[model samples]
Target: MTLVLSACSYRYGRVRPYVLRAFSYELPDGLTILLGPNGAGKSTLLKLAAAVVVPQAGRVSYGNLSSRSKEFRREIAWMPQSITPLPSLTAREYVAYVGWLKGLSRTDAWERAQQALRRVELTEQEGVRTTQLSGGQIRRVGVAAALVHDARVLLLDEPTAGMDPRQRRLFRDVLAKLVEDGVQVLLSTHDVADLAEEADHVTVMDRGRVLLSGDTGAFLVEAPEGTAPGRVAEGAYTALLERGEQV
Candidate 1:
């Protein structure tokens, strides 16, 4: 299914609010990187697409289905930038709980939860209380919860935030596998290095508005004339920051 946003805009409230202006894009079953500076509304846009937030104007639709519809809700899985777990729940229990909420049978929920824990390399930590885990470990548990249902659309906000180099690589590999399986992924990140050779599409946003959106390869190739070839990814990201400042 194609997730399309057409002229969608969002505002927090009437006062001290900035507009996430009308922007349109179609996301297919592959990795699309959402890149932007701090407070650029990357998170807001992801939330809007995931139906966690309503748009003030225009619409976001998945194929022919509106984002607010129950069908759309069932098809999308969202992982926020920072996840705080319930201190009392064990990692395994949390995953199982989310699985059940996603409509899995009790037996099936446990089975899927176990598989997800293994996939995120947290199987050994499953019995540990969420409060006992480190930040990165907790994030892994969050990822596992998102995967337990095998939803078609995955929206992740800074999935690699608290991960170390090894963990980051593991997460990337898992994401690659998901994309290969035809899962549509929309990921927001400040790490430009993570985007190279992974993202098929790129959308750059600044101050709650999209500045540029297109094929990743083309964006890298068309960067400013003085940008170093070997450092295309870094240079392009630097350019984006400069552009953000201009706005």
Candidate 2:
């Protein structure tokens, strides 16, 4: 499956259009990290892919489905940066609800909910109220919900934000597993230190345009030696931020 974005741009009232231009790249069935600094339109691009916000111009397509299609919604799992669960539901119940929304039968939804919790390492805490979980734990629950339907495309915005080092490692393992299973992943993160070994491709965006999009190995080779990978990534991120300001 591939997501194609052609000449997409978004505009809000009064201000000049955020000029996200014509760009097309195929997302293979592996991890693709979207890297950029704040306000570079990384989130905007993800939202465009998710079909949450309509593009003012151009089109986005996924396989045979357009961005507005129900089939497109079924094929993609989007985990936003901040997810607030229903106050009264337990983690397990919440995941089951998401599964149901994805069109799973009651029995299948419950079973998948259990498996999703296990996948996120939240099985032991399945019965805990969503409101009772810590920030990291809540994020795990959100991940579980995202995975419950087994969507082919997973779009995660900072999936490891509140996680500790160990949890981050665990999440990386989970992402690797998804890649192995042929799930296409598009993740946005500031955690460059943790990504070097796992991400297959990196797309660096600056001011609503891609500055770099290539294999991770090429990026490492191009980056200065003796510089921490995180620093290199940060420099690229900073450059994007500056570019956004220029626009």
Candidate 3:
């Protein structure tokens, strides 16, 4: 299954400039990393894929399913940049609630919530109220919510922003496992050094347009000779943007 965007255009307000203008992309299976600086329209693209916002022109679709279709919505899960705590809900409760919203039965949602929490290594904190958990723990809950419904497509925006090194590694492990299970993941992040190696495909966007996109191996090959191993992806991304600027 793949998510596709075609000639999509969007903006926050009628008078404001467009965040995405005639943007288009087709998601590849496995994990794809979306790299961009802040305000690059990365989040906007994910939101369109997630069906959280409708484009003023063009469309987002999953195969033949339209973005407006309930069936299409059920096939994907989205985790936004910010994970807000539900005032009084425990970690598990919040996840279960999300599953319920996704069309799972209450009983099934509650049971799957446990499994989701476990996948994120948050089983011990399942009963902890969201208000009492630390920021990283709360972000894990957001991920669990997205996983609870067993959706085939996962749209995650800046998922590792608040995570510590260990937590981030654990999150990467979870994503790798999901990909092995045939889940398609499109994750947006600014930390290219941390996730470039994890991607099967890498797409870089700037100023509401795609700068470059291709297989990870091909992208890494763009780095100049003698670039440090640790910064290869970052180097390639920088070189692409710099080249664009010169045009």
Candidate 4:
């Protein structure tokens, strides 16, 4: 499934007419990342793609069809920046409930929940109350909830937001594996280092505008005379936004 944003614009009305006046993007079937600092319109972009918010103008489509179609919604999973599960529900039940809401049968939802939990490596904690899981585990449960529907596309906003360095690394590794399995993933993050070796493509945004987008290598900035060229996402972030200002 391909997610495309064609000249999309959105903003809180009665205030600013356009926080994202005419942003456009295309995501292929791989792990495509959105890189931007806080308030750079990253979450807004994801929300449009997820069909959580309708654009004020232009189009958001999956495979050239509007996401409003029930077929598309059933196949797409969205995890916003913050995820909260019912405190009384078990992790497995939480995932099953998501699948059920997506139109799966009771038996199918329960079956898929088990497999989804296993994929996120939460089998041991499936029976635990969601409120009792560690912060990271709860995040994984959100992913599992998304996966239980066997979603064709995943729109995750700041998936690694509160994780430590090691946790971030592990999450990145998991994303790589998902790519191998052919899941189309759109992930948003401000931490360029998170995409160092994982991103297949990158979109850089700032102040409600898309500054640059293409293969990850296209935005890389050459290292300074003294430092290594490693972790170029940081340099790319600066170059794209600063260069846009000059234009």
Question: Model-by-model lDDT, in order?
Answer: 0.82, 0.79, 0.90, 0.82
lDDT digits (tens) for residues 1-247 of candidate 1: 6888788888887885755778666775588888877788888888888899988888988888899897787788899988888888999999999999988899999999999898778889999999999887888888789889877888999988868887777778777877887788889987777765468888777777676677788668646778766778777767776876786
Which of candidates 2 and 3 reaches a greater lDDT?
Answer: 3
- RMSD, every candidate, angstroms: 2.3, 2.8, 1.4, 1.7
Worst 10 residues of 3 by lDDT: 190-199
Assess every candidate by TM-score: 0.88, 0.87, 0.95, 0.93
Candidate 4: clashing pairs of residues: none
Clashing pairs in 3: none
Off by over 4 Å in 1: 225-230, 240-247
Clash numbers, per candidate? 0, 0, 0, 0
* lDDT pick, better of 3 and 4: 3
Instruction: Name the candidate, 1 or 4, with the larger TM-score value.
Output: 4
Candidate order (lDDT): 3, 4, 1, 2
Candidate 4 residue-wise lDDT, 1-247, digit = tens: 5788889999987587577877778887788888888889999988888888899888888885797788777667799889896888999999999889889999999999999998878899999999898777888889888888887788889888888877777677777776787888889988888774468888888888878777776766432334446746676677677776787
Cand. 4 Cα-lDDT: 0.82
Lowest summed lDDT window (length 10), candidate 1: 16-25
Residue lDDT tens for model 3, 1-247: 5689999999999999999998899999989999988888999999999999999999999999999999998888899989999878999999999999899999999999999999778999999999998877898799889989888899999999978888788888888988898889899997777689768999988888888888899889888999997889989989887876776
> Comparing 1 and 3 by TM-score, which wins?
3
Shift of residue 155 alpha carbon in model 1, Å: 0.8
